[model samples]
Target: MEVSKNAYYLVNDVLRAAKLYKLPSLAQLCRERLFSASPSSLFGGGVEALAGLEEIAEQDEKFSDKNSEDDPHKQVEIPGGSARTLNDDMKFALSDEVWADTVLIAEGHRIPVHRCMLVARSEYFRAVLAFRRSSTHLTTEAQVSNAMAVVNVEDSYAGIVRVLRFIYYDQVVLPSLNRKDAKGDSDGVEQEAERAEGAVNDYLAEEASDQLLEDLVAADKYRLERMKRLCEHAICVTVANCLEVLAVAELVHAAHLKQVAMRFVQTHLAQITAREEEFRRFQKDFPPLLEELYASLRDASREEFLLRIVH
Candidate 1:
C-alpha cells in the first residue's frame, strides 16, 4: 500500500515492456494491480480518496450470472471504446485528433474540443448544435471534427481552456456549463458555418487576475452554479480588483458576489474613497452601491454619536 516512487515506476515500466513484447495479457494483469494500489498517486491526485464501495447494493445472486456465450456483443447500438474516465485524460484527448469533435476559436488560436463533452456539459451548446441539424448550415471554411460544431470566443485562450476543463470534470477536475452562454458572438462562432464555443481551476487562472471576472461572466451566461461559487471564493478583496469585481459581479447578475464585493468596498471605504479614479468609476457604474456605502457609514456615525451622548 505504501509503495515507494521507485517501485511504482518500476512496475509501470514492466507493464509497458510486457505490452511492447507482445504480452498484453501480462500487461493487463499488471495494469489492474497498479490501478488498485494507491491510484491517486499514480494519476496525480484528485482520484476519489478510495476505490470501490461495499455499501453498494449487491445484485441479487439470482442475477449475477447473466453473461451469454452464444452472441458476443450486447447492445451493439451503444458506442464502443475502452471504458475511460476521460475527466483525467486531457493531455491525450485534447491532443489526439480522433477524439476532438469541435473547434473553439479563441484569441487567434483554434482550440480543438470534444462535441460530446460540450453537449453533455453545456445547455447552451445543446441548443446551438440541435439547431444546426440541417447539413446546409455548415460553412465551407469551417474546420470541424466529427462534422459537429465550431465556435468563436473573444476571451483569452488560457481563460477559455480553463472553462473547458471545468466542463469536462465538474468540480472534481473541472466544472462545465449549459445554454445562451454557448452561442457567444454568434458570428463565425460555430460551423452553421458550427455550433459554438465553450469553468475552471480553483478559480485557477494561470495568468491574469481578470480570469475571475471572465469565469464569472461565463458561469453566469452558461448557468454554472458551482463555477459561480468557485469564482466567488476566488474573488478576494484587493485594491486592484476590488472595484472591478463589484462591477463585473453586477454585470453577471451575481447577487452574492456583488454583496461580497460591496462589503469589501465598505470595509476599505477610507482607502477606496481616497482613490479618485476608482471612486468615480464606482460612482458612475454602480451608483446604488456607492449610495449604500454612504448610507451605512451615516448610520454607523449616528449610532456612535448616540452612544457618546448616553455615556
Candidate 2:
C-alpha cells in the first residue's frame, strides 16, 4: 500500500515491533518505505537530509561568500524557511563523579541527570527546568556553576527508573521474568525440565506485555513520543490483552494505541475475548470496553443472520 501520513508516523513503531518479534522482512519493508518517502518524513530523516541541504546551500546565491571566514548567514534554509541544523543529540560527557545538574526524585529514589539532556529531550522537562532556575531546588553539595535542581517525579520507583533510562539511553530493556531459578538444567543429574522452562517462558511473555503497558503510561506522562509509540506497538500486537492495553491507552490519551485496540476488538472480538475466564478478566478491568465489544459482536451477528434470511 502507498505510504500515507499516518503510515509515515507508524514507520518507527512498526520497525520496532517487527524487531521485537524477530521479523526482519517486516523491518526491511518499513525501512524501505521510510527511505522511499521524502527526507522530510521524520525530523528530516535525521541525517540523510543533511547532505541534500548542504548541496542546496552551496548552490544558493545566499551562501556565495566562499572567501569570507565568518558568514553568520551561512545557513541552509529548509522547506519551512528554518535554518537546518543537526538534531543535537546532546551528549553529556562531564568528567566529575557527581556532575549532574538535575536530580529527579521519583518515589523518593533520587537520580542524577544532566539538565541539558533532559531539556533537549523533553518539552515537559524543559519547562520544569526553566521553572526550577529561580527556585530553591539547588542543593548545597551541588556545584553552583552547574546550577543543580531537584524535582520530585510522582511515579512508581521502577516505572520512573524505566522512563529515565529511556531518556538517557534511548532505550530501556524491560525487566526479565523468564529466568526461573527453581529448576536447573539436566545432565542425568536432573530431568531436562522442559515443561518448567516452557511455563517460565509463558510467564515472561505476559510480564513483558504488562511492562509495556506500564511503560506506555510513563512515556505518555513525560511526553516521550517515540518511546510511547514503541510501548503502544508492543501492546497493540497482543490482541488478547487489548482490553487492558486499551484502558491504559485511553487513560494516557494515546490516540494511535486506542485506535489499534478498538480495531482489534471490533475485528476479532470472539477470538480475542474467547475463554470465559479471560473474558471475565477483561470485564473486571475494563467493563465498558467489554460491553462495547460484545455489542459490536451482537450487531455483526445480527447483520449476518439477516443477510442469510434475505438470501
Candidate 3:
C-alpha cells in the first residue's frame, strides 16, 4: 500500500527532527511516534510508511555491511575469501575483540590486548574488572539504571559481571570443562591454586553491601538466573545473621518460604510464639505481599497454603 503524502511529510519531519537532535538511538523516535502522534493524523504515514522505513533501514544495514568489507579499519584478511560476505562466526569474533577494547576504555584501565594474556589469566576476575571498567559505555541514565538494578537484584559478583558483559558487549561467557595433560600433575595443581586465588581476589574486590543489594534487584529484573541464585544464596549464607536481610529475604522468597512455612513455624515455634507481638506486626505489615506471593505460587504450581491456628 502507498503512504499518503501528508503522512509521509509528517514522518519525514519527525525523522529530520530526530536526526538533527542527535538522539543516540531510534527508541525516542519510536516512542514519540507511537505515543504522541494521533492515529488519524498518522494515517497517511501509517502502516505502509512504517514498512517502507523498515525496508530502508534494512537496505542501509546491508550497504553498511558492504562498506565494512572494504573499510580500512577492518582490514583483516581471510584465506580465499575476497568476494564472500563475512560469516556469522567471524563477525562474532570481531565483535568480541571490539567489545574487549571498549571494556578497557569504559573501565578507565589501559591494558593492551597483548598484555591481556597475563592479566586475563583468571577469567572470573577478568570479567569482574571488565564490568566495573565498561559500565560507562552504557551512555544513558536509563540504561545505567536498568543495568544497576539488574546487578543489585542478582546479588552475585559473578552473575552481575556476566549480565554487564552481555549488556555492554552482547556476549555470554559460558563455563567449560578444561582438560589438562594427566602427566602434568604439578602444573595442574598450580593452575587450580591460581584459580582459587582469583576467586578470593574477586570477592575482596566487590562493591559495598548496599551496592550489592541494589545490584541483586537489577539482576532479578534482567532475568539473570545465575545472578539471582547467587544473590539468594548470599543472603541466606553471608547476611543471614542480619535481621534486615532476613526480613527482606522473607519478602523476596516469600513463596519458597511459604512452601516450607509449616516446617519453619514448627522449628522456630518458640521464637514465633514467644515473640507474638513481633510476628503479629510482621503479618499485618506484609499481609498483602505474602498473599500475592502465595497466590502467584499457587497459580503456577498446584499447591495451596493451609494455615491452622492452635489455641
Q: How high is each candidate's TM-score?
A: 0.55, 0.54, 0.25
Candidate 2 stretches greater than 4 Å from native: 1-97, 134-145, 172-192, 236-240, 263-287, 302-311
- Clash counts per candidate, in order, are 21, 0, 18
Residue-level lDDT of model 2, residues 53-91, one tens digit each, is 454435432323531334444332344654222222222
**lDDT per residue as tens, model 1, 1-311:** 34444565566667655544444456567778666766556434453423211111122121222322333442223124433244445545656667677788988898888888777778876777666644445555463334746788777787777777777666422323222334436666544323333122323332245666778788766666778788877665566567888778778778888778777776787787788887787789778867776787787779889999999
**Ordering by lDDT:** 2, 1, 3
Kindly list the per-residue Cα lDDT of model 3 for residues 1-311, writing each as its tens digit: 23544554555555444434433234245446545644444444678657655764575456557556655343344447532232434344433544243222223323212214313333443455457547567787576534421111223545445455544334444443233323325988878877877665445434333344444455455545455455554433222122233355564553342344434443454565566566566567777644654465465444332332321
TM-score of 2: 0.54
Evaluation by TM-score, superior candidate among 2 and 3: 2
Q: Pick the candidate with the highest lDDT.
A: 2
lDDT of 3 at 38: 47
* Clash total of candidate 2: 0
Q: Which order, best to worst by TM-score?
A: 1, 2, 3
lDDT of 1: 0.63
> All candidates' lDDT scores?
0.63, 0.68, 0.45
